[model samples]
Target: MAEENKQIAEQLIEAVGGLENIESVAHCATRLRIMVTDKEKIDQGKVEELDKVKGAFYNAGQFQVIFGTGTVNKIHTEIIGLGAPESSSSEQKKDAAQKGNKIQRLLRTFGDIFVPIIPVLVATGLFMGLRGLLTQEEILAIFGMTPADISENFLLYTQVLTDTAFAFLPALIAWSAFRVFGGSPVIGIVLGLMLVNPALPNAYAVGSGDADPLYILGFIPVIGYQGSVLPAFIAGFLGAKLEKWLRERIPEALDLILTPFLTLLIMITAALFVLGPIFSIVETGIMAAMNVVLELPFGLSGLIIGGLHQVIVITGVHHIFNLFEIQLLADDGFNPFNALITAGIAAQGGAALAVAVKTKSKKLKALAFPSSISAFLGITEPAIFGVNLRYIKPFVMGLAGGAAGGFFAALFNLQGNGMAVTVIPGMLLYIYDFLPFVLYILTNVIALSVAFVLTWMFGFNDKMLDEVNQ
Candidate 1:
């Protein structure tokens, strides 16, 4: 079976231009993405003939040969060994056109790593940030909770679910990483968990008010990447490699035993001592960069991330930031993720709103209006994929409007610290001293309304209305 599979893999590689014609290879749930220099060079017919290639596709301006779940990476290696080509500008343009896949692949990557256990992350972060706004004394006044309210069983239950995510964020990342990369992320995660766990010995008892402990070389020290990105990513990378090697080489007879044994030994030592801490530092540096971006002139950050937000979502990399946002809520009170997402939804909704007004096709109009409303409520997938993505002018208009909304919203310091929904009004949460909360709210409202109006006025207008009146 292995020999036959290898031969088929080799045949598949040869059909796709001996691998040299290929560029980079990536995969999501259902597809294998291969970037090729000359699309003409690939023998699509021969590739289709391969038993391993369930189906074939060409997308994102890239030549893609689809493969089922675990098969992608194996074939990818065989293809790379056969020789993939280097990328060029024209190739880059083609990949750009395949924007949707790029987004999907990105999200699948991060989501694959994180989605299994995101509810805790989201609910916890939301509670903590919002709770800050409703402190002990404030909670007592607003909700009429006595001092006992702080220790109430209900509150404790809520804290357990939410704080669990925060306290062992890196461990969760490690677990997600394990799913993605297949090493002992469990070890990395546990190491991280121990660091933040109040029950653990000393566990940063040395620190005062967020001075966070940092103990090296003890019980496999791992820099907590809880609510972090880079550290889990790095550990997962190593773990996956180790896991893959173990999966392929370890005997099936002792598979369960040896696989984890080897995986844990290699992954634990590497992650705890190396990847865990190293990537934590890297994560911090990236956060610093994000802070710099956030601190930039209000409209610019909005314009950039807002305009790019939907685009990023399409490529699936947006979840990387979704994870990043969780990290943001964990370490800081305010987060740009929700605010930026609000812009994306509004921008997309504006485009769909135009289509609903302008398209002659009943089908298009039917899809557009409802979809637009959904995006307004913070659900952008349907509008983006079913409407705006299908139409060029509307999408561009939406993007422009989004950029404008983001720019001004950021300018006005409009933010939603908790449970930020997609609707324009969600920005109401950021109102505070030194923040132009009211101004942001008004300007953003104007920007989206104007975008919808302009889209209809210029190209999306009802020509039939005039003819019928005449």
Candidate 2:
């Protein structure tokens, strides 16, 4: 496998205009992200044709070659070993496209910083959903008991698994943000730990009015940052920049000792006294606005967001929505945005499956089948980029399907206990209630049937299938 990856890496190097044209390289869960100096120097078509390369797209100024999951990491490692200077970070690559827009850059930075941390949250979400199932009155009644009758230790174990991540989310986000911003992650982590120090009142209690906020300057309210995203992000960025600024002026002789010590003292103070209070207000307002949007009339919000969600995904701005979903989950114990997003994803899968069934060309069928399955499994890029978008009609049908699913999700007030992961794998997120789980299945089926029927009627033709093969 190593040799095969290196060989593919060699082909990819020459195909992307070699080491000279390449500026930097990185990888995500499924694609090899490359930033090149001159777009015209590389042969995109040839890169697409390379063995094991599923598809290629130029989005937001980055040339992304989809190599699937496990395969991408190996190929990316080989490419880096071949002397292509690695990109400073994935956000840099994401930012190369929208550098002119401040909001875009900030959103990309958040996306890059949080992507690594999402897995833990996803696992916790799944754990929570499963815990709800096992402890449900209905599920337990079948076994002659209720949640109250469950063993104390087993319940405690489940609580630890499901609640620990959210309780210390600030630390995870801070550590990741600092790494992205070029600071010592360990220092960042320590700073994060300080935000949730035992001496301070818990953030949830403060929010719930169970505990009073600490006062600074006799007016500003300082609260511990637990289960908060925006404040941690801001604190991490400032902390990283401060560390860098101090390192430059401090003499090398006593740098190591002084730098870390001073950085922590300064950042910890600012995060507690200044940044925490101000940014916490800002985060609170943002979360309030999201809730209001979700409450919009006749489910118009979900209809529109669901219809355009995949469009945002194509532009790579969809990561910003992850923050919104996380906030919703943290604040309300449910995420309606996740349900809407799942509709969009299932629609993409539906469109791809339609093409796979209808296409006459063996190659197109081969491409569409697995890509559709992948989309159903919560990875939609393959279906979206490699199949549906290649046929514009199917993609349009998908939007219609998505809008339908979203409308119903909103009408039913459908929600999940999690963010990230959708469809097949997403069942873990909705296992909390039998009704919600049934609705989840129906949501996907509605999307699937609508997109499939629409595409079969209008999306493809034998001529397009021939072109696809050629």
Candidate 3:
């Protein structure tokens, strides 16, 4: 197995114009991301045809070859062992930054800032779903109990699990943004904590009219930023910049004391008096706009977003949705976008499954089956780049499936208790109620059936695979 992996690695390096043409190489969960010295020298067709390779694409300045999860790791290790310059994901990202347009770079930055924070959010979402399941009236009745029968302490404990992350979400965002922006992460945490300080009026309380904002200079309204994304992000950016600037100018002897002191003093003042209030309004407006779109008549919004979601994933810019989904969960405690996008994700699996069942070639069948399984399990790169996308019709059929499913999701007013997980594993988010669970299942079924049937009928045949292989 090791020798075979080494041979595959060697073939991959040669396919991409030899080791000398390679600038650096790295791997993510599923792809071997390579930055080459010259794009013209690489043979994409040969790379795609190589043994153990699933598919290949160039995006954000990297030539990414899908090799499944464990397989990609082995190939990457073999590549490094064969004298290729091994690069960290961070270094590869830097190379990517030098290639894409301004908007692409910005979206990638948002991705970097949020990717580390998603696991906590996902766990919290699961906790919330579990709490909802336990507290549902019908579920309780089945167990011969009522909400009142549940222990108050247990309820409080559930709240701790579900609420703490969101209650101090600004801190996490700030800390992450600070790290991304090259600032002191500990300082960012301190700054973020100050934004949600118990001393100030709560932003949610102020919005709900339960508490008035504390006035600064008898005019500027001061409120703690709780459950806010934009405010913390902006504050982190400005704070990091200030800290970096002060570090450069401060004397070495007093750098530690003076840099943080001056940085915090300036940032806290700017954040409370300026950034918080301004960006809070901006954030509210953005959320309001998204809600208006989501509430569009007859599920038009879902149809449009769902059809285009995977197309965006192909561009590698889909991570921007994390910000929107996070904001939705923070403000509304429910994420409808999660329900809408799951259809798109499910359709990818469905389309891949169709191709897997229809293909005759042993090699194509081998790639398609496992790739479809990966898609059903909530990772779609293999199914997408490997199978469905290679056959253009299947990808389009998947889009149609997504549109149909999304329409149902919006029509039924489906909302998830959490975000992150999707497809089969995403069933956890809908277990809160029988009706929601049923609707979630129905939506995914519609998506999967539509994609699978359409692709089986029109998307694949043995001839196409034979031609590609030839």
Candidate 4:
């Protein structure tokens, strides 16, 4: 495997115009993110055909070659051995700055901020699911106890999982955003601490009217930025720029002492008095817009999201939904969006399986079967890049299946205890609710059946398989 990775890395470096022409290289989740000195010198088609490469595309000022999860990391290490410099902090900031138009840059920044924080959220979400399961009436009966019989310490420990991440979310977001925006992360973290100061009223208390926000200047209200994303992101950007400004003006002798102090003072005051309240409102408006879509009559929201969710995945922007799901779970205790996305994922697997069952090519069948299994495990890239997208018709069939399944999911108001994991891995999220669990399986089955039937009917032929071999 190490030898294979080395060869793939060498091929990748050559395909991207050699180590000399590359400005920087990095990996994120599933792709080799590269910044080249000249795009025309790179052979994109050759990169796509390389062993272990799933797909390749250019977006946000980077050429991204997908290698899935573990493979990308090994190849990345090999690339470093082959003399491609790993991107420095400054290089990352420059790449981020070069990303796209204003809107795309903002979206990309949002993704950068949250991608680092998702694992904790997923772990906590799973704990929440487990907590719910242990406390369920049925489960409690089996244990010969009632919900009240659970120990206080155990319940408190559950809060350690379900509550901690959202509570300190600002710190995480600010730290990442500041790094991405070319600022000192320590200063950003200090600013985040100020935003979520122990002295400030908890955001939930303010929202629930159990406590009042401090009135600043007799009008503006200040509250802890808990479960808030946009505020932290906005504040991080401002703070990073402010720190850079300070670094430029302060003398070297005083830089260490003064830069962080002044940056924190100015940015914290501005966040409390101006940016925090304003961006909080903006965040509310965005969440409201999302709710409007989900609340649309007759499951239209589900049908639309289910039908189109995988398209977002293909573009690699589905991480944005992590923000939405985390916010939803923090505020509402459940996530319907993830439920719909699960349907889409299952549909992809189903369509791939159908193609696997029908194809005459041993290689295509081999790829399709395992990709389908991977999809069922909540990782769909294998099925997507290996099979469905290649055939085109299977992908469309998957979309149709996803729409049908998602329509039913929303119609039943199915919700999960988590955001990230889905399909079999997602079963934990619904195990506490009998009907929702049944509904979850039903949604997958419906997606699989529909996609399987459609793909079997019209998606594959011997001619297509023969062409694929060529």
Model 2 weakest lDDT span, ten residues long: 91-100
Which segments of candidate 2 are over 4 A away from where they belong?
1-15, 18-20, 23-26, 49-53, 71-104, 465-470
lDDT of 2 by residue, 338-415 (tens): 888888899989999989998787777877898888889988888887888877888999988888888888888899
| Candidate achieving higher TM-score, 2 or 3 | 3
Across 1-470, the per-residue lDDT of candidate 1 in tens digits comes to 55666777688767767666666666554356667767777887677556645446465556656554466667655555545543433344346455546555565567566666656654554565455444446456788766565766766676675466665666777677765554565555654454344543332232233444456655544333445556656666676677778778887898878876776677656665677567667877888888787778746887787777788755444556666676676665456656765776787888777778777867567667777776776666556655566444566677777777787777766655544344654543444322444554554565566568766765354554344235
For each candidate, what TM-score against the reference? 0.64, 0.90, 0.97, 0.90
- Tell me the deviation in Å of residue 252 in model 4: 2.4
Q: Each candidate: RMSD to true structure?
A: 11.3, 3.0, 1.3, 2.7
Lowest-sum lDDT 10-residue window in model 1: 200-209
* Best-performing candidate as measured by TM-score: 3
Best by lDDT: 3
Off by over 4 Å in 1: 1-108, 125-155, 182-225, 247-258, 314-316, 358-361, 389-391, 417-421, 424-444, 462-470
The alpha-carbon lDDT assigned to residue 111 of candidate 3 equals 93
Report the Cα lDDT for candidate 1.
0.61
TM-score of 2: 0.90
Q: What is residue 173's positional error in candidate 4, in angstroms?
A: 1.7
What is candidate 3's CA lDDT for residue 258?
96
